[model samples]
Target: MSTDHQESVQELDVRDVDGEPFEQIMNALDSVGESEALRLVNSFEPVPLYDVLSKKGYQYDTEQVADEEWHVTIRPE
Candidate 1:
């Protein structure tokens, strides 16, 4: 799906979640628009998030930017 719609991809930098990444990410997901995607920045591979979001009808693509940094782009299926 094209993200050129009215709502652009919403980005959330959760590298500093401090043990509350799930809550932070869930909140961010709440604001995602139908045509928009959620781009998450983290310090590690958020393996659990993939499963959580998958169950919510979202799919993701991940890329490692550094040894300890990753970028995950999530969109509705």
Candidate 2:
């Protein structure tokens, strides 16, 4: 199956993002509503980000949609 399906939640695609996408992700997360989820699309699993978000008391679920595409849904715990 293709990994490019449309997202049903708030999303940010960083595949083409220049520089580090960490700040961009943080910015996107800041705007997430209480009942919403932030989906981060990237070229690979963002393992480092998992630690950062986890320490901040957030929860997430990651799926490797394709060999090069990963989607991480992050939300407040």
Candidate topping TM-score: 2
- State model 1's lDDT: 0.86
TM-score for each predicted model, relative to the true structure: 0.85, 0.86
Per residue, candidate 1 scores C-alpha lDDT tens digits across 1-77 of 54454657888999876776898888888888777889999998989888899899998999999998899999777
The parts of candidate 1 lying over 4 Å away from their true place are 1-7
- Give me the displacement of residue 33 in model 2, in angstroms: 1.4
TM-score for candidate 1, please give it: 0.85
List lDDT for all candidates, in order. 0.86, 0.88
On the 0 to 100 scale, the lDDT of residue 52 in model 2 is: 96
lDDT assessment of candidate 2: 0.88
